[model samples]
Target: MIRELYRQYKDRWLLELTFDRLLRWNRWWPQHRDTGGLLCWGSDKVPPDEAAHTWQGAAYESGLDNSPMFDGVPFNTKTNQLQLADVGLTSLYIADCNALAELAQVLNRPAQAAELRQRAGTYGQALQMLWSEEKGIFLNRRTDTGQFSDRLSPTLFYPLLAGVATPIQARRMVDEHLLNPAEFWGEWVLPAVARTDSAFTDQNYWRGRIWAPLNFLVYLGLRNYDLPDARKQLVDKSNQLLLKNWRASRHVPENFHVSGVGRLPSEALNRSDSFYHWGALMGFMSLLEQDKAVELKKTTD
Candidate 1:
């Protein structure tokens, strides 16, 4: 996003201003969250009065507050991280490194760019270990027990965004998981949890709801590969989701039902914040798709 901002506005000063802080944040993840070289979501010590100071704080850091992925996962107080080495956190960190590296290059800092690229490569290698040939997708592993979490979410597809999954691995993931009706793919599409998972019935926040950010991130990842069919489906369905609510109540929702059952944000089961800006990202995906189509047409013309 920062890169896009710089690209659109050509603001060198803005990139210069934010570069160091972004670099620090990229560095902080591995330094503090590293568990056997793969990252986990963690929290630093906080005051007793802090509501999220516990394991819940670590979950908060994952941005999936109540995801079943962390259910009964132990918190390593010693490391201040969840015992699970998260595929999502590690993949996102790699993406951050690559993004920061691009910013470093733009700022004419070759040494910093090299360092960031090296960090991304090292972590990318570690992330590859999370891939399960049997499952045909990456799984989060418990650092304590070295067991893979059976729970799955859209975050697993983040490896594509990080450019870590090989073409074959990416194909397997898409064919066996992403497009599977029993899992993430459906009429509504890309549920936070697989339809087969018990959590899907909850239809609560992260349990099985469709989140715009998840769809957007996964959509970005799909753009990295040759899956035009999947990409178009995602863009079309995301646009449909946005329009369905917008045409009904003139509201963009914070999230949507995985089953495509709700129309208004006021619906109790939907549990969405009406008119949330993030929800508009569903529409933004279509805009991006349209922009790409125009660019392709111009090139072919």
Candidate 2:
């Protein structure tokens, strides 16, 4: 988002204003959430009476409230961290370090840029260790038993966004997982969980519902690779989902049905917010693809 803001507005002042704060946030993850060098979703020590301040607080920190990924996962009361080395959080932190490094260079802070780059590399290597060659995707590891969580979500695709996946690994992930009809790909592009997963039938928030932000983030990850077909399919389907709901009741939903069943916002179940602004990201994907097409045409012409 900072990159897009700078691209459109060239606002150095805004970047400068957020750089130090972002740096602190980047550091905070490793400091507070680090579990053997890989980060987990966690909270600082809070009063016991604080609502959602325990395991639920860690889930909230993941921005994936009630995702099945956190289901039954243990929390370390001693550390205030989930007992899982989250692939999503680790990949995102690597991406964050890379983005902060770019911003540091843009702001003429060479030392900070170098530091951020080094951090990215360290975390990137650690994230790569999460990959399951047998599963053809990265899985979250239980910090307690050192077992990989079989529960899969779009968050697993984030390694591509972090630029940590090799091209061959990316291809395998896209082919074996992302495009699998029984999993993510279908009438709807990407569901929060694999369709075959038991949680998918729940059709609940972050369980089986389709989220625009998840689609958008996965789309960005696709852009990092040579997967043009997957990328186009995602953009087209996301646009269709947005337009279908928008034309029906002028609603942009926080999420959509995996089966493409829901239309009206009022019809949304499982606390899916109707008319949420981030839902517009579904349409934004199309707009970005359109821009890319136009740029390609110009170059060809």
| Candidate 1 segments whose C-alpha is farther than 4 A from its true place | 261-270
Candidate 1 per-residue lDDT, tens place, 63-148, comes to: 89899999999888889988999998899989999988998999999999999999999999999999999999999999999999
Residue 241's lDDT within candidate 2 is 86
Tens digits of lDDT, candidate 2, 201-283: 88778888899999999999999999999899999999998888888778888788776634334553546777688999999
lDDT of each: 0.89, 0.88
Candidate 2, poorest ten consecutive residues by summed lDDT: 261-270
TM-score against native, each model: 0.96, 0.95
Which is the leading candidate under lDDT? 1
Off by over 4 Å in 2: 47-49, 261-270
In angstroms, how far off is 291's CA in candidate 2?
1.1
Q: In model 1, what are the clashing residue pairs, if there are any?
A: none
